[model samples]
Target: MTVTRPPDVSVVVAVHDTMPYLTACLRSLVDQTIGAGRFEVIAVDDGSTDGGGAELDRFAAEHPGLFTVVHQPHSGGPAVPSNRGLDLATGRYVFFLGADDLLAPHALERLVDAADHYGSDVVLGKMVGINGRYVRQDVYARTDPDLDLYGSALPYAMSNTKLFRRRLLDRYRLRFPVDMPVGSDQPFTIEACVRAERISVLADAVYYYAVRRHDRGNITYRSSPAQRLDTARRLIEFTAGLLPAGARRDAVLARHFDWELSKLVGKDFARFDPETRSAVCAAVKSLSAAYLTGRILDRLSPAQRYRLALAARGRIDLLIQPALHSGSAPLVLEKERVLVHLPGFDEMEREHFVFNGAFDSRMASGIRVLEAAWSSDRLVLWIRAPVLGDGAAEPAPLGISGVPAEVTTELAVDGSGTTLCARIPMRALLGGRRHDIRLAVTAAGELYEFPLPALGRRLRQRRWHRGRPYRISVIPGRDEQMVVRVSRVPWRRALLWRKQ
Candidate 1:
């Protein structure tokens, strides 16, 4: 394709041997809701052996004015290809798209509109996952005209698949790290977010990040933990150099601890080889001890906080216990304390541990459920509420929807607050079908709702017992008590089951 004039946006695609999915990805860009004259595609074929170069050539020939293909020797990573595409980009704004991913029809139009309207140096479009769970739409729940990378939730949207003003990149001379094989885009994205004068988020615009269900070719999915951790260390050092030591820096690093670093202390930790385990443990311990402060650690979930604490202490062996449980362990609440009962662990092990109780500021005034457990016949909830003055309070009647059920409530006063234990019949609530039972307490002619913690979904681990064939999940709901989803096992084998 002959380049005549600069376009509004340049779509930079770095392709390797992604022939199977490249056609759909290129097609999505060509069929953009934005007019053809407004955008151009600059695709770099990084030494494709599987005829992907030919595919790009065909596309270029078909749309000479809109598509341009650059052929380069394999650099073993996207960094070189992306850098080449950047050099050849002749657009006011640059948007990077993966060769295996597609964009929503109006992605470029919305991003350009938002960038122009807000005069933003960087504009982020929402990313939706296809055939995988990589998408975090919550990060882009609202549109921000001027987002602070450190202060706002924009740091969570730190993928290179965003629109950047061409002048900003040229001024900063920003390019991806060519040496790093994995997580190469992170440093580039981080630096861009830090240097940009104004960044806007267009939550309505979507970029479909495709994950191949079979034979995924992304380097990240195939890289070893040691390899990935090396890049992680580099990224951490790079990020530290950008920001001063304070809440902002801690917040940015906190994401790494919560998501990436936490994997070392997850269920798969025990499965690693001795060398891999030792290396991972050492790296995680060092990273956690250096950056994971109480201020930042307090913001994570109970499970995460516990794991990080163990990591910081360098108790890799002890970390394995909680990791093995996989969040199925029932939480026990006593007075002001929250305890996790690990399977096969001694009572001393269970009693010695205490999790962070300050989930949110609302827990100070209203009632909060610290832990919940389910049995064949009953559902037990451990709750903490404000203490009554005289130590004498009327029992509040608990309500269970979907079927007739018996509710029993017991209250005890302690040094911290009033502890309420409620037991409800599970059979009546479930009724052999999936049900979201809402529990409420009626006192003084008013209904008081109990807010439960939002434990994210997990289909990978079988939390429910074998032969039971019924799984119950607790999701945070708009109303009281939380929403409970019960589902029968669709097959004899689990969803994520593999042959041992």
Candidate 2:
């Protein structure tokens, strides 16, 4: 028995600088088959200095009964504004839409129909990203969603693509972590999914997720250690606070932790510090206890259970996140050489970016097709001239800056093209937190900055210059000992002398 009334839904589309996309998103949403009486659109302008606030007000004025606008300064993350939505929401269900994305014509209707048919507490849909791009997601449509949270939410993950019963959020006090620059959605969605007694699936792909070549200044783009850990910390605390009163409570809570680690930590480990990293590892290690009483812990195979156990410990047991075959280049397939190229990239002049993993994909074929690790005798990076332009540039050696020692070396490149090479005495990185690696360059009369965090954290963003000099760190192979001190990674000797 689905909730048969013309159920009320609060469609919360949070907006920022993307007024253009926000306009289209709102248009498509209100234009949906579900009319104004069925759902209320709440556009929260999260301190958008770029006219998003005015645009929302204009839209609300035009669509009187269908729209409401909330204006506030940027809360730094999605959770705070989302909580604002919860408080103002007068609907029984909630739908989240990103400012720069849109919903399908029948998205709300299909989700509401599914919810009624199954009397489900939550409805999961799919988000297809990068318009006119060669990729698609039919995640929710293929699943037997009646299977429950662990089963459906496992692969069909993503909060923006789903709709939820308001009580599932209220009962568990589910809210986003405003502290995080990215990944605040994990805990909120996970809590709602697991705690909800029934969930429905609308196999229809109802959302458009636009993936871009370069996303600088995007909220998810400004990832940091404290933000990620804070999200995880809150999610765990949320679980502990809402544990049901019964024998199965421990079991469900344990599985919740397991799922959290499996999803959040793996995506964010290289971006965090050793202390927070250790906490995450411990959280992952203890997740198995959730299975005995969780949504579907008992149903998993022994292999799956062991893998979850390994994941919680923050161990990259290949079973959890497998080893990826590294070394790839676009357009050219040389044994070790790479001709790195991004179409229309050269249009912008002057950049100082080192190859850090982009798009955070575990697969090697992801964006830019480049990943690197340096633990061997020497490290080599080959760069080729796509089309030698007005003034040809060569990348200097990977230099160690921000540390006390003068440990900088030039890399070897064949005279024909630029091949960056670095060789160093092992003394530089002995105690972990002593140094920072920077790829320095001079073009158009200025020195750009790219500072590495300490050893333990991996950097995301394969391409960092948002139209300027770009620098980012390794994303996957994180060294667990060092840390970022005052935005610099200084050696322990320098630290020791300073303390004395």
Per-model CA lDDT versus the true structure: 0.70, 0.52
- Superpose all Cα atoms of candidate 2 onto the true structure and report the RMSD in Å to 1 decimal: 21.7
lDDT of 2 by residue, 1-500 (tens): 68645337888877778766678878887788988789988878889987889988988888887888999888876777777877788788888877777788888888777777777887776566663432334444574557454333343354544788887788877777666556677667766766778876655464445543244545654555555545555555555565564544444454444544444444455445567666656655553443334444444433334344444544543322322111232221122222222222243222211123331221112211122344442222222211111222433322334443333322223222223333322333332433444433222333433432233345322221222222223332234322222123335433454466
Candidate 2: Cα lDDT at 362: 14
Candidate 1 matches the true fold with a TM-score of 0.68
Leading candidate by TM-score: 1
Best by lDDT: 1
Task: Point out the worst 10-residue segment of candidate 2 by lDDT.
Answer: 360-369
Give the Cα RMSD of candidate 1: 14.7
lDDT of 2: 0.52
TM-score between candidate 2 and the true structure: 0.50
Worst 10 residues of 1 by lDDT: 387-396
